[model samples]
Target: MGIAEEQSKASAALASSKTTSSSRDSASTAPAQRQAGKIDVLIQGVALFSDGYNIQIIGYMNTVLAKLYPKQMTTQVKTRLSNSILIGDIFGMLLFGLCIDRFGRRVGIILTTLFLVFGIILATASHGATVEGMFWMMVTGRGVAGVGAGGEYTVCTSQALECADSTPEMRRRRGMLVAVSTNAAIISGFVGSSIVSLIVIAAYGGKPSDGIWRICFGIGIILPLAIFFFRMRLNDSEQYRKHAIHSKMPYWLAIKFYWRPLLGCCSAWFLYDFVVYPFNLLAPTLVSGFSKDQSMISSIGWSALVNFFALPGSFIGALLMDRIGRRQTYALGWSIVCDFGFAIGGSMIQLKNIFPLFVVLYALFQTFLSVGPGDCNFLVSSESFPTPLRGHFLGFAAAIGKVGAAIGTTTLSEALASFDNPTKGQQAIFLIGSAISVVGTLCVWFLIPDAPVNLEDEDVRFRNYLEANGYDTKEMGLSASNT
Candidate 1:
């Protein structure tokens, strides 16, 4: 045969071999791919559970710690203690977000888990002869844990959303999966905290014990530790893997490209936290204001009961998110339901004669929050940006939201202190949160885009943009199969 004919034959053989090899790889990987979706959701849920559990556990510890160290538990000290974890959270969100963007999801998660474990251990083991020493140690530990939790917020949300986006069936139900996991975490936190509180009460006969708070903090570590190995085995999302070869856009460039979506996610989260965290932190106080006859346990129990309302709200919101759209669901929750609930509840809260009305209204307010922004915030944030910058944007948004949370908590505390009438002060805080929610609603309406996005399409678009901008996009293919 001529030289050209021999070359053609060699090319044909090479193509046939490549096709056969691809088939073999696919066959071997099929089972693992089938299992990946479930595993990803499970891991994400566990991480979120740890996050919620830690937050509530610390909240529950506040009163106990105050009673144990009354002299050192001044308003300033309490504020500092509360701010410690939040400050750490701010750092964690930014740090892990960058790490995930650079290193990949699995690494970011493992690192976050380790930080959480370390922080929990430190906080649990904290002890000192001086109140100052003990306080700072605990604060530092909590701060460290906050870092991990903050990272978890970004990494886990991004991972879960990316995984969901890869599976068509899962993608349609993404809102439900993300919201349910998050709401479940919140419920788990409350349940865990309540159980610990009951245990402390039982062990100490309604008195404080040195080990009570320690056990609570220690228990917070169990779930995270149990899942650490699994997290280590977790794979980066296929969407990310397909795009990982492309050089990342500069931070400023990524911002410029995604600023509108970022604004939507950040502003919505800020508003949600601005309303939710304060109400949550002050729940017992709010309940007490309405029903002065309730015991501490009764008050705690009522607070937990109120959280149940959020469960159904989340499911409803998830359904709405899938059926209607993320933007509408968010606006409905924030502007229509939550805004009205706060406005109406705040107005009625001052009317001491209609205490039951106030309680019912307050529960409704929480329920609205649960169904709307509460369940949808993570989903919107994670889905708004492309995979390469998703973590950074989500982390940044979460950090901003935490800022809102810190402000809300501080302002509410001050308002409660400054106003001679506690009821009026709490009512004022509610109005402020409602007003903020209104602004959030406006932001969502105008700033957030309502469109279905395919992750693979996004990656292709991003790669095309990169290629147009003179970046080498030849290294990675345009499509990645779900795994």
Candidate 2:
């Protein structure tokens, strides 16, 4: 055969292979549609709780660590902590994605929990080391723990969304799991900060402290234990079976083909974290500017007490998401975030009395920004990709998000140093974050396209994407949506 004929034959073979796979997938999904049932809320709740717990641990680690070694900890050192954790987080994200695909969610969760336990204990023990050695050891432990956090968010979101019945009504129910994770995250920050404060006060008698942070580190092991036991009853989503039979594509190829959706998802997540990390960490550092002692107490107080309000904020955000649609919900949340940036700036300028009004406005702004974007970001992430690639996509977004987080933490330190007052620096960071949130919202509104709200739609989109690219998908007839 001539070169053109050979090329044509190769193309035909690839097309035939794709069609055959599509038909088989369609056949496999029929059973899933026939037996649509609600996923157990208790199981998903445990997964979400664990996910929130890990984020809490990470969210507070740098602040708590800096407190422990006040004389030795510089802005540069703190930035390293942030960057190191992100590095570890990326590895964990990738590892979780691969494990979930190959070994299933239960196995993946179980394996990662083991890592969390080990990492936390090791980090806590680092407190005993000399300052120079301890910093590096603590960084290592956090990195490992971050990996566990990455897994929890990525795998749990995918698993929760997958197990829901795929009917339209059921799809809405599944989407609530995203809210569960977000609600838990906001609450955990409150809880973790409180826990850290109580431990510090009791151990150190309200003085400049270090040892109490070790207790904070050790406490990280508890949720993973609880989650592992609870997740024992959980099972893999029905969609995986369809993918196995229909796509006939190796899991890796399926993921590679869906990279576009993954890119959009990751970009959104990166921007979300860029704003969130600086905002969250600002509480402790900004407060520290007033007095070292007051800073710790104030951060602890806000984290514990203020977080009570975040649950309601998240619920409201979720309700709006269900009502207003994902794009509008995200746009509204980001707009609020942007508005708060100006509020923060104005409040800072009015600091003649260091007004109670400024403090109250800042806290409230943190609340809306915390709950709203968090709710929208996780929800969009959960729904953006199909079950087969969901975990990988989540992981990819998480890995990239960590980079944004590092930028947040690192820039926060610089902003603080450049301005004489830490509070002023914080106002600057908030202003910048607010601007980013606005841009992020616009990106979602104009550029980020919508996806199928049900499994049938998801299947059609997947099949269509392949077919348009000259791949046949006649074999996998499966397109059942898990309601």
Candidate 3:
């Protein structure tokens, strides 16, 4: 045979061999077993990394900065530090999203570890250096850690959402993976807050409490290292690899296709952070306003105990989100947030007398807040796009949310500082936050698509197009056009 014919024959033989091998491998595994194992691992990994940072970082940001920059750490300064972290988050999100699909979740995670290490070292080093210099270093450290968090949030979630088998039973199971991270976050928040309270109480007994924040920061470094080492055992997801090879697009085309869902996701996130970021960042100052005495410090301890109540609410929210759908669950959560804000506003108006009432109301707010926004945002954002764009979509969504978070801190700070009475101004901020949350809840309901729970139900408009074009249901596994 001539060379051209020989090459053609050889190519055909290789294709046949690969098909046979693929078929054999598919035949060997029980579908149920394979789906269960992969989805579970995905959920666990996502949960591990998310909770690992949020619990420590979110709980301590206010207190940590307050200790280091007591004189200069106004709400605006605190917000700027937060903004710096967000700047890093934006870069990491784009970088990780661009590469995660192309390279794989495992590789992206390994890269994230480097950012985490750098962040931790810089942040910790701030403590060792002069106080003024430490302020900038602390911001630098948070920025690096944020880059790692940016990678972790998008890549890990996309890996879980995309890799699950396209079956109803498997999809519900897979949804749990997305919830795991937030669940960890809620749990960690409770733990971190408790630690803060314990340190405060110890100070009431004359022990030095100034150093406690440093311990939290030091401990924060350990979680990422542990996650990095654990993730080293995980493999690159098969579905992502398969999709990368089969449907790869020019980068521009992918962005064009995904812009709408991406925008919707990011907008939802922006609203979420508007309340949560500032609330957490300025919590220490807010608490201090009530009292600086031993009794007042004990109130914070009581508040920490109350925060634990949010954990269960989050667990239930995650379960119902998968059942009732993302839109409804999110809208419901925000509605509660708005009402909670009103309650908070009322308590702030009477801060001296209704301290117990404020703590109780705040606890309830924390519960639903922990469960609803965090989990729903991840679920909706991760599922909003096709596998190719999932990482980019989620990364950008998170970056926007961080921006909102940064603004929230500054706005709250300015509001607190400028007010004739800082306490009443806080009440006004709550009222405004309540209105914003309601608007966000409305946006999700009116504008966004009904996110499909499984891969088979996706590309819904495209599915309709296929049916209209005379595609057969059995051959394509697509619904025929009712039209």
Candidate 4:
């Protein structure tokens, strides 16, 4: 061969050898990397399980508070008590959402646990100069806890999504893992709250006593601390490491590209939570209206059982997410809920006469709640955007959803107080929720865009989109330590 041709062939051969060696290195690490991703997601999800348990258990605790401090647990006090974390959700979601995007997932995740620990410890040890003062102290403590809980929605889901994107095998099931695995924990939290309250109340011989209230609040501290340690062991997700913005983001440029999907995500979450949280908060109340002879404890057990039905629904949603995609699956779930809700709400009078049947139908309605919006909100919020902006959009959507939860809870409480018959009030909740679901369905069709499941894929599109709009993509990426 000629001298020039010989030099070119030698250079190409050396480059190919280096590429093969790199592939070998990546192949060797892939399994461990995948396993670490699973561990990371599991740890984050456990905190959510605790969150579900901690937050929902309060409904049962509220019953105890009313009995123990008749003069203290006023309607207004109860409202604040129920909404404390929900109100906290707004601030937590907003602040932590921004922080996670700006700082890093590790920083946001670790800091959040401290808030939870403080909130839980302060709440469990709630004390003041007087009984009335103590109750407000409890409210403040829970509000703090709510902030932690609110932040969890943003950080946990974002972290979990990135973790699921760690490998192709994992990425294919990302919908099921991110949506069902973590969300099921939240739903299970609802179940755990009900069941644990039932067990604790049973320990107290079917009573909502001082001890019952304290124990329930105390149990919330465990997971936050456990996960705090787990979180310390974690590095930022590889995806976050790869594409996270190292400098100030161009907000105007981001909006130019993402605004449409952002609107859909925020609106869907708001409507879904508005429809769902009220029914969840008032489960015992609804059960009591139907089962006139049951005691408060019996109603709590039934609520647990009712919430259990959502677990299956969440799994079904996960499957649907993969098969049909996010927008379609969410729409189908909402449509089913709307139909069943209208039927159940309209038939309340007749169904009350057949209470067992009513319970089944009520649970079935709750099932679809998880199947559709419960699954969709987190998946859509976390997935539609790239890693750098995932926290922002997810947090914004969650914060808006919490506002809906707060308003829905308050409005339903008003409906219950306004109506002469309690059944009428529940009927109103079902019907109104169904109508809201219809609006939610429309948002999905018109606004919500379908997104790729893989983090790398979405990041590419986002980077390219930004470049098209005169923004730089080179400034984003991991440092050598991050890689």
Candidate topping TM-score: 4
Model 2 off-target regions past 4 Å? 1-42, 58-68, 127-129, 166-169, 186-190, 208-210, 244-263, 291-295, 306-309, 467-483
TM-score-best of 1 and 3: 1
Task: Return the clash pairs for model 3, or none.
Answer: 310-367, 314-371
TM-score (C-alpha, index-matched) for candidate 1: 0.87
What residue runs in model 3 are displaced by over 4 Å at the alpha carbon? 1-69, 127-129, 163-168, 183-190, 193-210, 245-248, 294-303, 456-483
Report backbone clashes per prediction: 0, 27, 2, 1
* Candidate 1 lDDT by residue in tens digits, 1-483: 443353344334543444543443455432343335756775687778778778766655666776688888876677677777777889999999888977788788788988999999999999888988888899999999999999998888887777777678887777777766665556556556666766775677666677888888898899888887877776777667656543445565456456777888888888888778767766766666666576556666666666556657777887788888888888888766645656664675456677666666677777888777887788888777667777878899999988888887778777776777777776777777777777877888888876445665555545444444466544442232332
Per-prediction TM-score, please? 0.87, 0.82, 0.80, 0.90
Displacement of the residue 23 alpha carbon in candidate 1, Å: 16
Residue 319 of model 1 has an lDDT of 77
Better of 2 and 4 by lDDT: 4
lDDT digits (tens) for residues 228-252 of candidate 4: 8767777777677666786778787
Order of models, best lDDT first: 4, 1, 2, 3
Evaluate all candidate structures by whole-model CA lDDT and list the values in order: 0.72, 0.63, 0.62, 0.80
In candidate 1, stretches whose alpha carbon ends up further than 4 angstroms from where it belongs are: 1-35, 245-248, 290-294, 342-346, 349-351, 475-483
Candidate that would win on lDDT: 4
